[model samples]
Target chain A: MTGTAEPIVMDLKRAPNVHAATQAKGEALRAALAAQRTGTGLAAEQLDALPVPHRRVERWKHTPVAGFWSTPEAPSVQTIEAAGSEACPVPGLHAYRMVFVNGTFDAKASDLPVHNGVRCEPISMSDADAGSQGPLESTDWFAALNQAFATEGMKLHVAKGVILDRPLLVHHHTSGENNANFMRHDIHIEANAQVELIHWSTASDSSTGMVNIMTHMSVESGAVVALDKVQDEAGSLQHLAFEQINQAQSSQVRVHTGTIQGNWVRNDLNFRLNGEGCETVLNGFFLPKGKEFVDNHTTVDHRAAHCNSSEQYQGILYGTSSGVFNGKVFVRPHAQQTNAYQQNGNILVTDKATINAKPELEIYADDVKCSHGCTIGQFDEEALFYARSRGIGEKEAKAMLVHAFIGDVLEGFAVAEVRMEVEHRLAIKHGWDTWNDTLESA
Target chain B: MVNIKELQASIGETPILKGLNLEIKPGEVHAIMGPNGSGKSTLASVLAGREDYEVTGGAVDFEGQDLLEMDATERARSGLFLAFQYPVEIPGVSNINFMRAAVNGKREHDGLEPIKGKDFLNLVKEKASLVELDGRLRNRSVNEGFSGGEKKRNEIFQMAMLEPRFAVLDETDSGLDIDALRIVANGVNAMRSPDRSFLVITHYQRLLDYIVPDFVHVLVDGKIVLSGDKDLALKLEEKGYDWIKEDVIA
Candidate 1:
């Protein structure tokens, strides 16, 4: 609401970090320019045609890029030795711990997996990395940016008919002054292959910093893959993350992303079904307290016959934190029998906090089921009253209804541990003892 | 747990219940029968502290406190339970979870820690059994997919769990068949004690046969026009409300 004609560039780095970041960004760009690598050539070309996007672009319309630009200049680059641990550790059964530090692959600290037909390779100039999420074609601008600049990125691929019971864990930890970390991961799976992968992004510090990352995923026909992305960065970091989804015919793709921590962050996700009978699910939950800002924009396109896409995002905001959720679903002309659903729901605790929700549906086919809705509400007053009247207190009653509102989303999640832990942590953010005591009259 | 004196209540510009009076003590079941538009449900809503219904003229006391002054939830927490004729179905909310919150809410008000998971589960189990509510229904979302009988039974089950001091059975028998009615009545009968009171609101005497009320009142034109004993309910069932409105309140 302020009057400003110039790009509101908020400097993020102090003097020391800024100078090193400039040099690192330049070196990373030079590396990609030197490589004549293989990928969807179109992806790289798209990256070449576009400069670092500014506020002028409509696609990046609502996002505040100043948070990314005005950041304290990049911190001085530290060698892998200077940073103690490779990546933040999460306990579970992980087959491979692929560690990336400052966008460079730390091979010495990384653990390799024995699963056949699955390859984890680091591509700089001559090598190429691939994985099951999707094949990164050369044409994706974001992927190209990562390929040119990524000091370290992983390529994971699954062979047809191979199912890995354990999760392939990818860890990202960024540290240092001369930091311009970019990564492009190309994932591919043979037809009829099934893969389960968890991409864990976390930073060691809650101090102020910046991170911008994108993942490109393309799943082949008859392939089924379940992807879980968790963002558990500290509250003082500025995070700009994006993911692109491309699905083939008769394939099933499900994505569950939870925003566990961040000070200021914006994530964009796009899912496209290119073949018949493809099913894509894009679901997310964001819980922001304090002065956190978490924005998520998603688009799903049913481009072929019999494709189905559903998007549901739940947000719980407290304090002066604000959240924005914008979603769109499109049914192409020939996409008959397509079913697309999108909904965004937010709960605000304090008066100063705000939620901006927008849902849009575009249908070109007459015989399609498309729906979109957005709601900004607190816990249901009647429901709360009903519980309290049973002799429950105000705090306890509100907590009951809040858990009730989010129970549906948590139930739909595939990972039990993630869902349970999310509920536990979210309860804390809402300032309740348990899931049952954090509600107020909304 | 119940006291009523010259009870007067209204809604907006029109008066719904005018100069109505009734009384009940713990350990007694009273049935209030009336025809449509006779302020039967209004009595329940007003007692439950529904803000839309204005209690402009009547003085109501519940368990010795000013009932009308409290909010709906406060009224409920104060031992006033109204079993809605059409139970509000909260989507995505399981019955077990809902009851846990409610029971724990009540306990917390009494300065108690939350019910343990094991204890709460068993509590719902035993109470749900009282109403013969299907065990499977307890795990499903609250009233989300319930049938007529199931919804009524769930209402009674809720009452049993909360152990309200004064309960209003608003049209509990309206949609129930003979079997469901009998089960609901049995649950009510099981909960009868010297410390609790029941007000059964119905349009017919058939429910009276199951609930076996100690007093019967005929309500019409927003007022309790006549009061009698069990025999009065039999009389109204046979004679119909047309005669009661014309011969009594008028």
Candidate 2:
């Protein structure tokens, strides 16, 4: 894997003498992606037209995707039966299901739902898997690699005023070999339409590789959509899921992402509130155990007037794992009365575990109630001692305190089954505390 | 449940408890009244297995087991509870989850299965009303913005929920108002049993009027200087603790 030529590279905006870091990573993504395909049908000039943004791109400095992709990537995804899907249920999801094995969308093992306003289809089905899925915008080398050797991905849309009765569930299950899965999903919720979508991915021990994924969400006027994405795959899987939000006037969108188990999981959720009187809420909970690296970065743009947005993301990191969170609230020069508030709090149980957080506020207009705060701390010692003195052992005591740490975010799930699902994953991720002498000690 | 004989304790290099001895059987309520900086809190801390306080020389036997040898959680599992004078605030964690973990945790420690969800809710509701704590506050962050009286009431609510065999109420009456004081006293009264014991720590004698202590001990500096029946609280109330410090602790 080492001594490999230019691992992965990106093509920045091609400015006059870009920053040295950006230039270096751009070269890396280029080399890493070259092995995917040798100018496969798409001419070299056309591939050059593709967009892959590097560090200098806004909101990407801290995440550092250049180092995320391993030197030698995984084998290709011939096909897969995403196991444990039936046992891990999604009841209200009635839309067409697109199951991915490694990275190819498998329509055989899925049930496609029909509705007047909704359409779910595999993009490669019509193109005979030949046409290139036009360049990934502002994506990194991993995403570019996914586009290079990609097999199949999904495209979903909802018609205006035809609010679907159920959600569309997509299962991205990886298995059998160490492989690279690159996927790009384009989602559109038309005007005055309401929809719920869930992306659940699962993997076992054999599924070891890097997952570079991207999702684009566009909501028209008066549209409402709730998105919940959970990654409970094998702990050895390194993955990335990036999402961008394009919003219109009076559209309400709530996106909640919960990751209780994973290896290296980084997500960038960028929301552009391009209209006035728009309401947006983003809350997430990440409970990572072992040596997992979870980085979550979010940016909410107050592009219009009289708009309100709230952001809260909390997580509990245990063992030797590390987590990073950066939440930015941007109030454009004229976006007055923004009423934006953002807070991120985390608890590190073991001394070796760590969480780095940054909550920033950029307010351009006056008379706005925009405030942000971030905290990375240990559990309350007194509170732990109190619970322990009441017969809870060190681990359960720590879990109890941590359960308290993410209680607010967990309560915001709204759906009983989904809330409990996330909570159950949390319990399992930290379940080691529920075993051993400490379990009996409690 | 607790039986201590001539217990001596020290903080850092200075001694706080010197030859202090007491016996608390089930169903008996004993109050330790002392002025500020006395070993009143120290006694409670040591009983709760707080490691900061040194047991210079003492033997504390609870339920026929070596109380001082057990860790904080072990001592608690063996049926001991302490209501702190100041309950630490744990932000972002709801009261329901914390309470549920605690109840189930304690039950698990007793080698008993976890309490059912419905039954636990009923118990929480019953215990919550016993202290007049609002259900809405249970949904709020744990004491994140609770008032002084609310914290005290919360301590009592916790005590009612755990139902410990021996409880050490460390200054449970300190920041409480008259109404809160009665509610707390009523909660303790409801849990009174021939199989449960209490050690109330307080400064003002007002709390003694509601949950009257069976016996009162006036502590000054680091040692108990005087010990008497419940009337001793009223007498000390009228005469002031400085006099008791002069007569007994001297």
Best by TM-score: 2
Per-residue lDDT tens digits of candidate 1, residues A75-116? 443334556654435544445667776666777766756777
lDDT of 2 at B145: 95
| Fraction of the true interface contacts (Cα pairs closer than 8 Å across chains) found in each model | 0.50, 0.66
Per-model CA lDDT versus the true structure:
0.72, 0.75
Task: Report the CAPRI category for model 2.
Answer: acceptable
Residue B61 in candidate 2 has what lDDT?
88
Q: lDDT per residue, candidate 2, A1-442, as tens digits? A: 1222111122243443345665565556556656654423333443455444445654455455555444545544444533434523455434546677666767677665588978767666644343444444433544445555454567777899878776667778776554567776777789999987777877776666677677878899899988878888873777888787878999998888888778888887888888988899899988877888888977787888888899999877878888889887888777787889898988887899988788867677787898787888777788878767767777877766666566667666635556666666666666644411122112
CAPRI band for model 1: acceptable
Each model's Cα RMSD: 8.3, 6.1
Model 1 agreement with the true structure over B41-132: per-residue lDDT tens digits: 99988888767778778688887898877876677766778888878777766777777777766675568897878787777779988988
Could you tell me which 10 consecutive residues in candidate 1 chain A have the lowest summed lDDT?
A5-14
The DockQ assigned to candidate 1 is: 0.26
Write down the C-alpha DockQ for each prediction.
0.26, 0.47
